[model samples]
Target: MSNSDSSTTKTNGDQFARKGMSNGHASGMGHATVEIQDGKTVVMDDGRKPPLAIVLKFVDVKHTVAIESRFSWSAKRPFQFKRQSAMEKEILHGITGSVMPGEVLAIMGPSGSGKTTFLNLMGGRALRGMSGNITYNDIKYNKALKRRMGFVTQDDVLFPNLTVRETLMYAALLRLPNSLTRSQKIKRAEDAIIELGLERCRDTVIGGPFLRGISGGERKRVSIGHEILTDPSLLFLDEPTSGLDSTTALRIIQVIKNIAQAGRTVLTTIHQPSSRLFYMFDKLILLSEGHPVYFGKANGAMDYYASIGLKPLIAMNPADFLLDIASGNVNDVSIPQELDKSALPNGNDEAIQPPAKDVREYLVNTFNQELAPQERAKLFALESTREELKLAISEKRLWSITWTQQFSILFIRGLKERRHEFLSWLRFVQCIAISLIVGCLWWRSKIQTEAQLSDQAGLVFFIAIFWGMFPLFTAIFTFPLERAMLAKERASDLYRLSAYFMARTLGDLPLDLVMPCIFILIVYFMTNLRVTAAAFFLTTLTVFLDVVTSQGLGFLIGAVMMDVKKATTLASIVMLAFMLTAGFFVQHIPVWMKWLKYVSFNYYVYKLLIKVQYSDGEVYDCGTGCQSVGTSPSFHGIQLGGGGMEAWALLLMVAIYRILAYIALRRMKTGG
Candidate 1:
């Protein structure tokens, strides 16, 4: 229904201009510009004026990590490994810089030089184990300050199944201030969509490797859009242009420049950048081995280096040259004789190049002695003249939405994200195929006689086992997969942990329960375990309890082990153990293991299914005559647990496992 030519772009631009005029979000000077981008029509920009906001400053920031951590542990004796106190290493050493409104600061360095670490400290993503003074508008990082900040990580943490519009809408709902009405929040989300020029693909899914959706460049934009929805004044991006092509990367930088020009203070870490991209930054901080080599105007960086007698032998990208200098690759540059000479004690060897480490040390020392003092003085002077730390945002609620609103919004988002897999064509076919096979295999399992009654009990047990394992396997991956996204949102103070936990755990119900209902309808009638309406619903309820309890165990295991492969493997082992000890597979678990059946929630499900279909002291016809169930060996282990206990036990397990999962998730909310 839409076209992608320049005329279409013009029309789209006009439509956006009118919408902006109506909503008062794009308050401006004049008309909008339109451009044709990659066969898609997009508005160039909306006329929004800059509203000066924040000035970010950090001083003497440092961070250290254990050199001999778990990765260094022995494979043969992993449990015996311990890190000595001496095995610590510094990651960021006395790094300091600042960026004010209407300016974009780019952090550049070689790998392991702590560019991202420095950015993380400034953005308030790293707290403990870090020594620093990171403040926004003269205020330290806090819940209120967090609400006004945004961070785009190196890896785009997003719901791959949700459309671009939906992702931004959910962020708006959860992250916007409570002062805004529902309609206002929705308006804000729509405005972001148009503002980002994502109108062409607004409804398209933000896909992953397996799912085809938005282009990588657009996906990156959506990541930016999510943070911008709250109208954050301070934005931090860790390599937003990473993995992007030259033109796309340049475009991304330009967009970020536009954001900075709108009175937002932006900081981003970038790798090798082209000359065109290099000139876009207002300021640059060059790091080397966790030490600051240079912190000054981006345009004057090369001039500063040249003044210090370090200049490239040939024309090259400024970013590449800076990286070379930061990496101690001064051999390619004409370094000052004073710095080039090494402490070899052999001679004043003009013929030999200094060691890389020596070169790095010189760069660090030179900056600390000359430029650092002046930079600090200027930033402090600016800070003194700035208004007081209070931004009125500090008194606002840390979380934007009420508990009920968060629950409902998050629930809907979860449902949308999961529907592609939960209600997929393949899943539908899988449910049908499995149910048909089970129904045909257990056809008309008559329970009139003693022998057939055992067969009926087998069918009941199989149903409980099937639903139990199905949901557990599926639910095990939920939290582990979402850990990164959860960490990012939590850092931004988007929503309450309790709100997210409840929404995620309970939101799965509608989709999780669908296939079970369908499978039960088919398998129950075909197996003929029970014929009456009450018996049918009771059986369904029993299986649902089994599912709920098992899912809780899955969540617990997943939350505890945030690795997908490890969590899935552990779930398999745990579920297998539960099934074996639940009295269905083994007649007599050893006395020491007898207590395990009580611990296994599967035992409860099996018990409830039997009670639903059969009464106490029930009898069945044997070859000789009607016989009591207690006299038969077929129902030996199942009957001993007694009746009227499964429901409460299963419900208890549900609560306990969910609570434990929530607690585990809280430990990771701060990304500790």
Candidate 2:
């Protein structure tokens, strides 16, 4: 061969060798050889046997999640302060199972059967009372292992304003490792969208109660896509198909099956799946009343029931039959005496001998005797393989991004979400409309009379109340509506709680400032209050500060109560109390109740406005005589501090309320 031809051949051979080496390493092979046989290239591996690849196209891989849990809870003792009582009911009782990669494990149970609780335990999201031992591929479950897993909650808690792509991209940014570059993160999010069949609605907004957006199924897929952005090895989904139609539900399960087939461990809670969907599950965990009725192969469930002398009627769906047995609706069926004596695989007769009374007892006894030992043995075998395998555990931080990155991403996301909320637009419109109405009502007020001065003061006080009460009441629903989403994300350790709280506070500030500006601009010029540029700007500043302070109050209530109704009711009561004692309505206060006004934000705000307008030696003409309004009877003993001092005081209140809200958010528990 010529020199150039020989060099070319050598280069081709080197490329083949590199490809073989990469494949060999991925399959856990120590060495590989590329050979030319029969004019064709062949790759041979010489090392330990390779694991069964998820499919011919995917690499050889395996991941197993084994969990054993017994959980219960404590409750507050009625009418007893600082006292607690442990509930007699058990949430889970010695539940044990193992889910392996390349398979789907379906957890099914009737309502209140601890299905969700068990899933939560496995996902490391269980409440404080949970007691469990969970291991991922022989590594004990911890924050590190949690990083390699994905959790999709039952409720599709997504940002209603963002498109499907934006939602996944943000999730990718927050959840993916720092090792991935921006382009890689974007690509991963795109891949997840295509993988979950969300391309059709990639740019579609995830709509909520008021916004027009994606369908329920599409939203559900987006939620799933959010978790899968990092391509986690293990995925846990809670009722993923819960409100979806049969076709969409089957499609979701199929996509999930495809994910498992791609070498990811998938465990999902399903409620009454169709026959086809039921068979899609590789393993089935049937739970009832906090007890495991069966934990074995999904396809073999019917046969297992037959083995226990409880054969379902022909053509009956296996899932329904299992549910019937779980619910104790099945009639007693006699077992053959000889079969009862037959030794199970574990050399135990417990499987053969049915319980004398409850079906649940019989099923649990049989599973413990016959299947538990085998499952345990399988788990041990899988764990034993880990000793020889070189498993690299990537220790990752709870948050994948830095604090600044989290704040930035979260701030941008919050702004986008708020932009789409109907209430947000409504608040803006309400501010403008109320401003116009108030300006029209107090049109061109002149301080020609002392009573006109009072009227102007009333208008100023009304402005304070409008700006303060509106934002405060509207902001009350902010945290409560998104509490579920917050809990789910926090449970997954996506970001710091402080980061989210701060981002939310800062993100809404721009809009908050803008709305008040529009209101004050229109009303300031029309109402004809102090015409000086300094006075107009000062009034604007005071009103903006007042609105911010009110919003801070809203945040506190929302965070502390975490329920819209309760927070709204509490905020209404508090605002009403503030209004009653604001010094304008009730001039003469009782001795015991005189200090209440000091606690009211409205009182401080009214005082600040009064000082800003009248503190500069302005005069008003009475019908009989002209007098200085600043030194009038209404202003006597009110102590109208300097505008700067009053501004600082309003700012101080804002800071205090915001700090308290942050504290409450930090102390609040996201999930049970």
Q: Taking the candidates one at a time, how many backbone clashes does each contain? A: 0, 0
Per-residue accuracy of model 2 over 591-654 as CA lDDT, tens digit each:
7877778777787777878887775465666666766676665653566547566667778889
What is residue 529's positional error in candidate 1, in angstroms? 1.8
Give me the runs in candidate 1 sitting further than 4 Å from their true place: 1-52, 68-86, 343-352, 386-397, 616-619, 637-642
RMSD of 1: 7.9
Q: How many backbone clashes does candidate 2 have?
A: 0
**Which candidate number would show the highest lDDT if scored against the true structure?**
1
TM-score of structure candidate 1: 0.88
